[model samples]
Each structure stands twice: as C-alpha cells, then as structure tokens.
Target: MNASLSPLAILGIVAVYFAVLVLVSFLTSRNDSNNADFFLAGRKSPWLLVAIGMVGSSLSGVTFISIPGAVGAGGVNQAFSYMQVVMGYLLGYAFIALVLLPLYYRMGLTSIYEYLRSRIGPHAYKIGAFYFLLSRTIGSSFRLFLVAVVLQQFVAAPIGIPFAVTVASAILLIWLYTFRGGIKTIIVTDTLQTVCMLLAAGITVYYIAGALETDFSGMVRLIRQSDYSQWFFFEGGWSDPNNFFKQFLSGALITIVMTGLDQDMMQKNLSMPNFRDAQKNMLLFSIVLVFANLLFLCLGALLYIYAANVGLSLPASSDLLYPTIALINLPPVVGVLFVLGIVAAAYSSADSALTALTTSFCVDFLGMRETDVVPDTQAGTQVLEENTKRKRLLVHSGFSVLLFAVIMAFELINNTAVINSLFKAAGYTYGPLLGLFAFGLLTNFRVREEVRVGKVRIPALILVCLLSPIVSMVVDYYSAELLGGFQFGFLILAFNGLLTFVGLVTLSELGEPHGDDFTGTDYA
Candidate 1:
C-alpha cells in the first residue's frame, strides 16, 4: 500500500488539533478555575453546545471505526441491522428525558449517585458510584486504546516511537487541556471535535463514492442493491445476536445504563442550568446520534464495496479497515481528516471521562459538596477554595495515570473489535448500576444495608451489587447449554439488573418507603 501522508505530517495534524483544544481550555478556565466551574461548568453551559458535543463523546473512536467495520463484518451488526439498536436508543433516551431527568433535577444532585444514597442507604450510594468508576474507566480505556493503535501503526511506529510512549503522550495531552477547565472547557472543545468527526466520516464516504465512479444517488442505489443493505433480522431466533428484538432491546438497555446511569454522559447533561434544558439536550442528541450512526453504516458498506472493486485485501482486524484505507490507500486529504477525526473522537470521550471520574470521586468518596463554602472571611474562603482545587487537580492527574495504565493493559489482552469488547464489559460493570437505580425508582421496599450472617455484619448492598454481575456472567457463559441455545447477548444488562433487584428485595423489610428528601447517614 502506498502511503499518502508521512508520519511527520500526521503528527503535525494532531499537534495543531490539540493546540486548538488547549486554547479553548485556557479561554474557558481563565476566569474561574474553581470546583464548580470544573465539575458542572457552573451550570451555565448552553444546551445546544452540550447536545452537539455529546455526539462526539458518545460516538468516540469506537463508533468512528468499529460501527462502520461492523456493518460489513457479516456476523454481529451485519448490514443495516445496527439501526435497530439506534431505534432502541430513541426509546431509552425518551425514558431518560421524561423519567430520569426529572428525578435528577428534583433531587438537585451534583453526582447522580447521591440519589442512591438519599433514597436507599449510604452503602447503596457508595456501591453505585463504584460501579460507575469501574465502568467509565474500562470504557474510556478501550476507546483510547483504539486511537493509540491507529497512531502507533500510522504515525508513531514509522517515527520509531514505542506504543507505550504514544499512549502516554496521548493521555498527557488530554490531561493538560482538561486538568484546569474540566467539563467547562470540554463543552466547547467537544463541539469542535464533533464537527471534525462527522466531517471525516462524510468525506470518506464521498471519496469512496468517487472511486466507485458513482454519484450520491447512484451510491445509494449501489448500497441498496448490495448484500449489506439488509436492515432488520426477524427470523434469526433468540440466539442470533443481530435479531431485531435482541438488538433493539439491547440498544435501549445499553443506552439507559451507559448514558442515563453513567457519570461521564450524565455530567454533560447535568451541566446545563435546568433539567428542562438537559432534557432538550438529550432529545436533540438522540436524533443527531441516529443519523450519525446511519452515516457510518453506509460508509462501512461503501468501504467493503470499494475494497472489492479494487481487489484490495482486507486487514486482519475489521477495526483497522478504516485507518488502513484512509492513511495508505486514499488521498492525503482523507488521511489528514482521519487523524483529526480519530484524535477528536479520542479526546472528546477521554477528557469528559477524566472530568466525570474526578467529579464522582470528590463528591461521592471525599464528601466534598459542591455547595460547601468555608464559613469565614473572603480571604479564608479563597484559601479553602484553593486547597480544594489542589485536591481536585491531584485526583484528576491520578485518574489520567490510571487511564494510561489501563490502556497499556488492554494492549496486552484485547483481541476483539473494541466496540464488542466495550459493550460486553459494560454489560457487567454497568449492570449493578442499572439494577440499583431500577430498585430505587421502581420499588417501595427499603433495603437493610447490613445483613448479619453468623456474627459477621456484611454490607448487603455491596455484596448484592458484586454478586449480580458474577451470577450474570455465569448464566451468560452456559446460557446455550442451560437455555437450549438462547444467548443473552447485550440483554445481560437487564438480567444483571434483575438479579440485583431480587437480591435487594431479599434484604428489604415491609415498612414505609423512604421519602424523596431522605438523606441517610454514612455507615461506620
């Protein structure tokens, strides 16, 4: 394959892109670098910018490359079947807007896990936040790993840089821009990154059309005539991963758990001034996300069609197909767009994850309330604020290092398409969250936080949360044998949540339900 851009050129593009983000960070954080500004952008973010920025953060590099590649991979998400999942996302987003958003705003929460504490017990609260921390860490690490592999293959490796340095450098760059401004800076930068990502996908589709010697309508016709154009799968039965009902239900549950129950995604929504504005952001984001995913699936079909027409051999990993063509097979302009798009995708998600992780840790673990102010003179308040800011900075830096380490670990073990691995991991890590929230919202029973077992008082909520996923995993592994070829697929989230709800029920007693205003004490 002939290379269109040298390693230096690609590196230059990435540097210029991050320089713009750094400028945005400086401008956004210059006046206010306090915790409020860092965490929720002082609740002054525009709904539209938050909506647009979320498109990039939610899609990430996983969607950019994996979704398109999955379209033609002919196993999971074959052809337009992924659209069924997108359609399910609409239902999930509607639930979030109508149900979850109002509940969150009613509680006036900085961290959504606070809802668990107020409604259930302190053990439930800590357990909820722990699951989110685990989920987002693994999710963001997988995303960053995708971009690192691309860079190592196309840019860093050619220049004799090791993959670890490439990964470390990428994380460091994200940390530098995000450490001060936090989500406040991310709101603006993510909007810019969203544009870069969409443009890259659109342009690649256009160029592939030109190479196929077809116009826009003709390209559509070609895709329609192709084998990859089939969208719905009704006859595949329960075991087929691409079955319509399976994909649609999984899509809705995944969105609810990954977005509504997630800190990284919800932090952006919560940054808006009111729940109404946040609801608007969620609705608009869902609409735009549907179209964005459709565009990617179309691009995937065209890529495979183009490869076949040119007799180009497919890569070993489907995730590499987009970068392989964009860098070595297409024009230099497309190569540049690929670099910008991947970097934009990577930073958009990683920066927000880092901010949300820090936000959750400080608010949920360290007991730092967003509304807490030193009850003293102006000078004393400033001193306390400065001290709080130092703690936040340290936490933010710590998570960045953690992310780098996780990505390195992923490089050693990851063998499947990242999108698959991501959702599979989410099914386990996010299942407890789904279950905890479901129990709180849907049931009137109050759980006993501690259950006595043979003179040992155990945290029932934590044990339940941990065991739900393990049980779900065991059930999933032997599902075919036990259920006569019925596979759980992404529906594992729902099952895991159900197990948690049942466990919580066992720990509950018949009593008056807790009020919405209940704020339980932390256990010793």
Candidate 2:
C-alpha cells in the first residue's frame, strides 16, 4: 500500500523552518554594530565558511530548474559540456589571484569599482558600478521570480496564498535576517542554506534512484551508457552551440566578468580576512563548484532516464523537470525535499545579491569611507562626521526598496527568455571595465596624461576597449547568421571581455607612463 503525506504537514514544516531562520537573525544583531558590520560582516569572516556559502549563493533557482531540463533539450552537450566552462573558471580564478586581488588588497577597497576611479577616471568608476547595479538588480529579481513561481505552484495554491503575497513574504524573510549583519550574517546563514540545499538534492536524488529501482552506483553506470555523457566538442566550428573554442573562451570570460568583476559575487570574496585568504577561497571555490555542477548535471540525466522509463511526456519547459519528476515519480518526502531545495537556491542567491547591491551603492557611488564604522583608532571619529549615520542608513534602505520594486516589476512580466537574453546582453557592458583594468595593470599606458584623444583626455586605448564589443556585435549580427546558431555558451562571458580589451587597445593613443616604474599601484 502507498502512503501519502498531508499538505498541512508540509506547510507547517516549512513555516517552522523559516521561523527559526528569522529568530537567528534577531539574535545575531548586536548594539555595537553599524553599517560596515551589516554590509561586510566586519570583514572578519572565516574564509572556508564564506567560500562554501558562496556555492549556494551562486546556484540560483534558475539552475535548480534548468539543469534537468537542459539534459533532455540538448542532450549531453547541454549537461556535460558546461564542464568545459568550469575549466575556464579555474583559469579565470588564477588571473584574479595573481592580478586583480593584489590591486584590490593594496587599495583597501570595499567596492571593487573604487579601483576604476584610481586607475581610469570617475567616469569609468561610475560606469562600472552602474552596469553592476543594472545587471545584478534585474538578474537577482529574475532568479527570485523563478523560485517564487515554484512556490506558488506547490505551497501557495493548496493554502490559497497569492503570488504577490508570497513574493513579498519571501523577500521580507530574507531581509529580516540579513538586513542587520549583511555579508557577515549571510556567510553563516548561507552555509546553513547550502547544506540544506545539498541535503535536499541528495535526498531527492536518492529517492529518484530508488523509484527507478537503481542504487547510486547503478545510476552512474546507467548514465555512462546514456546518450548525454559526452564532454568535449570541436567539430561543430564557431557557430555550433557546443563548439569547444566558443565554450572554452566563454568560460574564461564568464569567470572574469561574472565572478572576478561583478560586485555581487566579488563582495563575498572581499569579506575574507585578507587577500591571500580570499585567493585561497576563490581557488577552492572553483574546484568545489565543478563538483557541485556535476551533481546537478547528473541529476538532470537521471530525471530524463526515469521519465522515459515511465513513458511520461517531458514538460514543455526544461525548468519544470525537477519539480514534475519529484511530484509524480518519487514519494511525498522527495517532493517536499525538492520544493525546499528550490526555496533554498532562490533565497541563497537573491539575499546575497540584495546585500551586495546595497554594499556597492553605499561604498562606491555614495562616497562613504570603507572603514567608517570599524576604525583602527578614535581619530577615525572625525571622518565619520563627514556623513551622518542616519543619512547613510536611509541611502542603503531606500536603494534596497527600489531594487526590490524593480525586481518585482520584472517578475510580474514573466518572460524567461527575454530575461535570460537581457542577462547575456548585460554581460557585454562589463567589457569596458575589464579592458580598463587590463591596460592599467599590464601596460605602462598613462590614460589620464595622454592629451591626444580630444577633451576626455583619457587615452584612445581606453576608448577602443569601450567600442570593440559594440563593433563585434554589429559585425557578428550581420555576417554570422548564415553560418549556424552562434552558440553563445552561457559561459562565454570572456569573449565580451576580450572585445573590451580590443577596444581599449584601439582607442588608446601611443604613450608610455614610465614603463619600468609600473608597479600596478599608480592606477590604484
């Protein structure tokens, strides 16, 4: 006889779990804390914990929903080929450790954008920060919206909760716990969330295998015989969606822009106690992320294999596979675990983004001092007077509200493809910053002093970095349609970055800023 679980039991379990989370938040907030403590966790976090928390933070609900679907849609290329991109991520981390982290450490930067001001100009700094703001706010909302839909379908409908109410409630729960301690609080909570998410995934996978009448090793053997296990692709040329060169290059760029450059992702990295520790975290994170993704990809393959055995028609959207499979094929416990994981992934990513967005706005555009709240000495009191604590509070809180509203608006529209495209398009916007940093760090080009490039005064080299990608997009748009689908691997964020490098070189005029004296700090 089959046993079933009550809807009330599921709902009550969920409510109690969230209440515990909120209670933790209230307990952690202390009177001695200020804005910095709220934002970066006072920059005293243990690196490994922060690094692991980051894994959950990076794997959003979109990932949870999409990976399974990807297996059936494009087969092995979609599921396993992403590993190539992961390899590229490792390489990109090397650049961060060797090139980017040292500069950030030396400058004592809170927001990475400050390096732009020191290296290029105020225009560059603002431009970089603005792109980050636009990208993360829109991106984060899209992510949360994905999870909210799942919640609406599973939990809300049975209880008669409105989607809007659910969305607001979800954000509120995150803010309640996260608003006080900021990154510091998030690090601990994110670790907890990651464990929950992984536990949920492991349980669901176990149930999935059980329902399929196979053990873990048997599932692995089954995948080996399946059609979706191939890893490398080279014969399809540049236009093929899984083209090796394109994916490899894309992997490298995605890491540079999305991980190395983006404020939301890097903010967590900055929370570590020191640069060396941060670098170690980044490298370890890369290794762990590869394995984490592999788990998801394998789950995707198994979901499809199970669906085929039962003669179930695959869902129209790939994102629904994880949920549908759980609800229909597995037992009630697995279904509950699947829903919990969905919520975990969504909240983990969205909360970090909301916090990081506020941190960047406060530290970069608002011109607040980085070490304002936790100064080394009492003399720091004078610098603190320059900006009122209340005004700073208003600035952060208002921005958070605005971001929430914007994300909600985007969620209401419900266009997943357009949202995905916008995220891709926004990746191009970071090219200029990548180019500017590259030129400033690697070469002796004096962008500010070179007067030859009209009134902007920054070298034409910098201008080239800004324009190269627009030019590539225009050229590729017209010339490449006949070739094939330009497989813009979700990971090829590096190509746009390289395009920015090309632009910087073309726009920059010939000049040397004392070639031998270049110590990477002149720009910092």
Candidate 3:
C-alpha cells in the first residue's frame, strides 16, 4: 500500500480533502442559510455525530504529532503520565453536564457567553468573551502552526513555495469550506475528519507492528513490558510534574476551563436541542476521549522502538519525531496517510474555533442577540435576515485574517514541544474564566457592578479578573523556591481561581441588587 510521496502528490491530496468538505457544506446549508444556521447548525445536529466530531476538533494536528512525541524523548520524561489527565476530564465533564448545561439551555443562549451577560453585567460579559477570543486565537493558531511547519518541511519547501503562502493556503481552504454553513457545516465535516484521523492512526499502527514482526496481541504485550510503557510517578514526589495527583487534578481543571468553559468547545455541545441530548454528547465524548488518548500514547512508544531498531536518529525536538518517521522514514503510502491525518486533525480544530470566535464577537460585542430579530411580517423579516448574514460574513473573515497573522507569529518564535506549551498557556488564559463561573454558580454573591477608567465606568469584577492571574503567575514563577521545589504543573488554574474567588468576596457588600448587578433569572 504505497503511493507517490512527492510534494505535488501531497498537494493533490489536500485538494481532494477540501473538495469533500465543501460538498458537505453545500448540502448542509442549501435550505437554511441564516445566522442561526451559521452559528448553531440550526439546532438540528444529531448527538452521536456531534460526539464523534468533537474527538477530532479537540485533539487536532497537535495531538497527531505532539502527543506521540510526548511519550518521553519528545517531552520531559512524561511517559504514560498524560493519561492521568484524561481521567480528570471525566470529572470535569460530569460537572459540565450537571451544572453548566442546564443553565445555558434555560437561558436559550446562542453563545454561552450570554450567560456571563445575564449573570454578571455587560463589562464582565465582554471580559469573558474577550478571554475566549484571545485564548482560542493563540491556542488554535499554535495547533495550526505545528501542522504548517510539517507541511512546509515536507511538501512546500522542496517545491519552492514560501512558508507564508503555505500557511495562507491552509487557512484559506478552511475558510472556503466553512464560510457559508458555519457550525451546521462543521458538524458533519468534523465527523468525517474524526474518522479519517483515527483510521489513519490504526493503519499506521498496523504497519509499524508488521515491521517489528509482531501481531496486535503481541504488540500490546511488547508495549506493556517496555520502559516506555511506564505510567504514574509516585516516586517523584510533589515536585514532579508527572505526579499523578498533580496531572490528574490539572487535567480535571483544564478540562473544566478549556472545554466546559470555552466557547469553541461548548458550541458543539450546545448545538444539540436539549439538555438531555447535550448531556449525553458530553458523557460520550468524555469516555471516548480516554480510550482515544491511550492509542496516541501507544503509538508514541512504538515510534521510539521503530527509530531505535532501524538506526534512525531522533530529531532534536521531540515534536518532530512523529513527522520525521511518518513523512520521511516510513513507506511512501504511510507518508500520504500522515499528511491526510494531520490535515484532518488541523481543520477539525481550526474550523470549529473560527466559527466560535465569529459567533462570540457577533453576539457578544456586536449585540446581535438571539432574541433580537425582524418583525414577524415576511418583508421585514427578509431584510433583517439579510443584514444579519452580511454582518456575520464580515466578522468571520476578519477573525480568519487575525488567526492567520497569529499563526505566522508563532512560526517565528515557537521552540517548545507543542502539547506541553498549549496546556501551560491554557493554565493562565483560562484561569480567570474558571474563577468567574465558579463564583457565580457556587455562591449567591454579586460583585461591584461598576468600576471606573478615569471618568468612564467599567466592570468592577475586571479588577479581580486581572489580579487573579497576575498573582497566579507570581506564584508559579516562585513556586519551586517557595514550596521546596514543588512544581504546580497545571494546578495553577486552581490557585488562580481561589485567588479570584477571595478577591470577589472581599469586594462584595452582601445586600440586595445594586445599581446594575445580575443575580441570574429564576425561571421555573
């Protein structure tokens, strides 16, 4: 099962992939071409499809390359330690289904950020949405940035194409397929992509196993008996990053903030019409993700064995390990699958994020509420619908350009293993969001509604949001010296939220509604 692995051949593969995605978009959006359809898939997506689609959207190309690399050499001796974090995600998803989903559904929110507006005031709402836009822009672009570098090395540079052109073309293909139907289109596209990525991984595993002269059952035994298969870090004590408690706790908190609290991740879940279906989707995704992640870890161990056996030198950066083997050292046909798998991973994530950013900006900043619409008359409704679509198009395009620029910037300076870097950055960016929602849901407290920028009033809660992460950073920087070399790892989120919670409590007066505080509507 081999094919041409030339740069031109890779380019053709990409074109066929885009063609399939575009066909899906056209079929999905043919009848209902409105803002609602663009933002939420017209609230008609099947739960199982959405669940399967989320696997690719969340893992992306970063996982395709980075997670395998992280098995150890590509990381800080991480080994099977990453699985501890997956266990934590189960707890986080449970919280999302039981607490967050009911609130969002009851509010009839098109964008979950609306819950911020209804619970806090306008400024806090914007702050929440602003954090989402900032966090996702950097995170999504970084994921794409990883894939772009691989494509440039393997497919573009040999053919004499510029890196920026390669980057632009990748983003453009995503935009072309996603511009019309938005999430409605992405629902099916992501499902197909999810299948492509997993199948590619399974096939790659089979090939590697055959090369090692082992069957599937034998391969499992080989992995289990090897040093690379080692899991847990009990002997490393509190200071070790791979300590089970630290990774597991961090995994849970990161899942809560990054997926449960995130607009891009939650948008797909909310697209389901009811809390029951959405809850099922979340539960299914949580379980599937655990098994799916194990496969990547297994693949990581195999890559190292293959490299050692064949006398291939591992690349300087562990992030390059998977790509180096798949694209260069393996069979040409395997190289082709590697390209498809990476692209499928990249688009699943990038497309979901692009749609989410546009949705949040249009609904949160532009004040295009789900409840705001034209009169019931046919003529008036037609004009309003047209205007909404036009505005949405502009927002979507603007964010796409912004994402392209950020990804280019990342290409210029990124030097770390991408999977670790992503989770580390998320610890800071998503910490404030975790705090805001925790204080809102757990306690009946209203923060000071208005603070001032000179003569201008802003959300008083902004001060707490700003202060929490700052203190968290200070703690993280000095944590080793301050706590006898105890590394915080991902648990920085918990410390950040605790600091935020205390700050909010300190500023409260403990009374009835103030001038402009939101105490959440009691809709029974």
Candidate 4:
C-alpha cells in the first residue's frame, strides 16, 4: 500500500462529486419543488432513466465493496453462488411487475405500505410502515457509516477531521441535493452516479489486468480458469446457507420484499407515467443486475489473482481488500475514481431512503393527505401543497438527524459484513411486510380495517406483528438442534412472514370472497 497521496487530493474529489450532484438537483427541482415531486418525481420520470438510476441504488456501497471481497474470501461467499440469489431476484422482480405494481398503480399510492393499511387495519398498516422506517433507517445508516469510515480512514483523519464530522458532512451533502427535488433529483443524479460507479469498476478491473500482464479478453480467460470463479453450490444441501435452493429462494424473496415491497425502491418505479413504464424499468433493472453482479464477481477474482502475483498481504477483513488495493496499491487515478464510485454508490441509496422515510412519516403517520383530497380544485391543492411542504421539510430534517444518530451508534458496534447483517435484520422487519402484502394479494380475507376492534384493538394486531419476529427468531436460533440441523439463512424471512400471515388470519373476521377487497382503497 502506498499511503503517499495527500488527504487534500481525496477531499478535492469529494467536493467535485458533490458539485455535480448539486447541479443535477438544481436542474431537476427547478420546475416542481413540492412533496409530490419529491416523493414520486411528480409521476413523470422517464422509465429508462429510472431503470438506469435504480441499478445504482440497488448496488449501493455494500455491493460496491463487499461483493468483490466475497470473491477474495475463496469460499461459497464469492464462488459465484451469490448469483443464485441474483437469479432468484429476476423471479421476484417479475412478480412485482406483474402482481404488486398493478395493485399499487390501481390504488395510486405514494407509500407502497399504505396498501397494508388498506388491506388490514390501521394497526397492521402502522406496523408495516414503521417496520420500513426501522429497517431502512438502520440499513441506510449502516451504508453511510461504511463510506464515512472509508473517507475517514483514507482522507479525513489524516487531515485532522473527526469521523463524526465526516459522517455529518456526507449526510448533509445528500440532504442538500435531495431535500427539494427528492426522488426526481435522485433519478437523474443516480444515473450519473451509476455510470461513474460501473465505469470505475470496469477501469479497476482493466488496471488489475494490466498489472497481471493480461488484456480484457485474457482477463476473462484468467477469471474462467481460476478456482474462485465457480458459481454454483448444489451439493452443500439445505443446511448450507449457500445451498442453491436456499440462496435462490432467499434472493427471490429478498427482492420481492426489499425492492418490490420497499418504498425507497418502489417509489421510483411508481414515479413513472404509468404501469407499462414502471414494468419496463423493473425488467430492465433485473436484466442489467445479472451482468452487474457478474462483473463484480469477475473483479473480485482478478483482485485476488493480482494480489497473489504481487505478493501483497491480504487484509484480515475481506471488505478492506478492494479499498486497500485501489487507494494504496493501484495508481493514484484509480484511488480518485474509487472514492467517487463509493460515495456515489452509497449516496445513491441513502438519499432515496431519507426521502422515503420522510414520505412515510408524513403521509402515513402525520396524516398530511388532507390537502391532497381536493386535487381537482387548484386553489385548494396549492394551499395543501404549501402546508405539506413545511411538514415535509420538518420530517426530512428530523430523519437526517435520526440517520446521523443511528449511524453513530453503528460506528460503535458494527463489525460484520453490512450487506449480510442488513439482510438478516430485514428478514425480521420486512418479513411482516412481506406477509402483510402476500396475504392481501394471495387470499380473499379481511381483518378489522379500523384503528380498533371492540376490546380487540390496534395493539393486539401490532402485538401479533411484533411477536411474529421474536417467535421466528427463537425458532431460527434452535433450528439445527430441533429440526435435523436445518439452517434457515435468508429463508428465515419466509418463516417470519408465515407467522405473521397466520396471526393475521387468526385475528380476522370471515368475509365475502371478492377481488382485491381492501378497505379505504378510495383514500388515495
């Protein structure tokens, strides 16, 4: 590792990157700067651009760093087995496009979880939305913290800045661009960031190939010939987390829950002009993701192969491998590009997440849709928009602080690979969400859709949703001892969802069978 470049160089790169994003934000926000625009890009975003930007958001900082590291680990982690999950994602995306999107579109929802409130009762609805807030806040904060650490380790600390300040600056910078244009700005800015990230990744691979005395075609051959390039793991059986069935199923379910069900991701999809456009975006994103993951895996294999040839010591933590090589071992230009790539990837997801949190909090919890009730009356709509802006701003800023707090907390205790850890936690929260949506779509039943049932009120349903995860967690802890050494892995999400569904059914009153019978679907 060189460790010779000045911290000033890195700070300059960060400044330039933020300038580009701010410029994009200014351009996007000029026409429409309100909550609808912020939340749904005014429902006018181009499908192709949304698709491209989504690829960036989906990749995020963890994929930027950790996917390659998985390859360096020389086990199932990066043996291309992750692709099984990626393949499973295609199924999940298709299900979302065909089934979930139509429902959200028909209802004309801003927050996808609002569908839950319509389907079950306010109790179930609040649980679903709150679960997303909990999951995404923790998930996005963890990502932002990772990038902050990278910046601190390589740039800020060397220049006498504290890690806390670095984290604050990063969040503040994202807040600057997103607080106005919101998802609209994100769609455009994420396109730019996505291009930069993918190009940086390709360039890093090319340089590593140069160091290995090989060209692009030869690099491909080298990866194909390496032991690390293997992509399947069928013989491991159900107990193996990387078992094909386990990984594939987990991947599909994760996609359906995380991307399809998640407002941060789905908000962009819904921003498109119509269902056709949204479907196009989903299909394109799903296809491009297959190749994207393939590229990352190949880069990982190349990094390890290059390390062996150069006799560079592998970092103890695999996540450190990509940054160590790019910033120190590789050329200075590669280091500059790596910083931008990481910042772009991290902020791409983080910005949208902050916006979604704000939207959910305002629309779901605070009841800001009172003005939206008079869309046909322009004067009434403007008044609603004016009032909504103040509330939206407050919620957005509040989440910014909440994100900072959670990230600082994560800085205290986080040690695992964030990508894996995030998904595991999501399994608990998103599990209930998945069940809530699945039960709504898959069956023709109804729970008390109001805030209370006579003596059987909101907390009872909330309690059921809450306890479902705890029960699932216990069953997961003792799975091996009690169930013939079965390992649940990501399949734990399915178990958690099953528990919630049964609970919902148990609480429900029998109803007349009808098509998509949700209460308050007319609210939107």
Candidate 1: lDDT of 402? 98
Worst 10 residues of 3 by lDDT: 515-524
Candidate 3 lDDT over residue span 1-524, tens digit each: 13477889989998988898989998998887677787887677899999999999978987788888888672353678888888888888898889888888787777777777766556668888988998899889889998898889888998899999998998998998888888999999999999988877877888899889999998898888777887777788878888888888888898888888999988888788787899999989888888888898899999888888899898887878888888777787677788889999889999999999999999878977543466778888878878888898899899989989998888888877777678777777788888777777776667876667799986668988887888889999999999999878788888887887787777765764222343333221
Q: Which structure among the candidates has the greatest lDDT?
A: 1
Question: Model 1, range 1-524, lDDT digits (tens) per residue?
Answer: 34547888788888899899999999999998888788889888899999999999989999998988888887888899999999999999999999998888777778999999888878888889999999999999999999899889888988899999999999999999999998899999999999999999999998998888899999999999988999999998988999999999999999999999998899888888888899889989999999999999999999999989999999988898899998878887888898899999899899899999999999989987665577878888888888888899999999999999999999999878898889889999999998899988988898875878799989888888989999999999999999999999888988998999899998888786562355422211
Query: What lDDT score is found at residue 404 in candidate 3?
Result: 90
Worst 10 residues of 4 by lDDT: 515-524
User: What number of backbone clashes does candidate 2 have, counting pairs of residues 3 or more apart or in separate chains?
Assistant: 16
For model 3, which pairs clash?
A: none
How much does each candidate deviate from the true structure in C-alpha RMSD?
2.7, 4.3, 2.5, 3.0
TM-score of 3: 0.95
Q: Alpha-carbon error at 473 in model 1, in Å?
A: 0.9
Model 3 ranges off by over 4 Å: 1-3, 74-77, 450-458, 513-524
Query: Model 1 clash pairs?
Result: none
Report the C-alpha displacement of residue 45, candidate 3, in angstroms: 1.0
TM-score of each: 0.97, 0.86, 0.95, 0.94
Assess each prediction's global lDDT (C-alpha) against the native.
Answer: 0.89, 0.70, 0.83, 0.83
Segments in model 2 whose C-alpha atoms lie over 4 Å from true places: 1-11, 75-77, 373-389, 412-423, 448-479, 482-492, 510-524
lDDT of 4 by residue, 124-228 (tens): 678889999998998898778777888888888987999889988988998899999888898999899888889889889988988888888899898888878
| lDDT string, candidate 2, 1-524, tens digits | 01353456556666777876777666666553466666556667788987898888877776677765776677324757766766777788888878887777776677888777766666567767877887677777777877777777766877898877877788777777776667767777778778777777778778778878899889999888898787788887766667776667666766777777888788887776678888888878778888887888788888888888889898776777788777656887787777678777877888788778878887776766545553565667755743535555565567557656865686667665432454465555665666666766776555543435455555444455456557656545654564455545443344556676655555455665422211222212
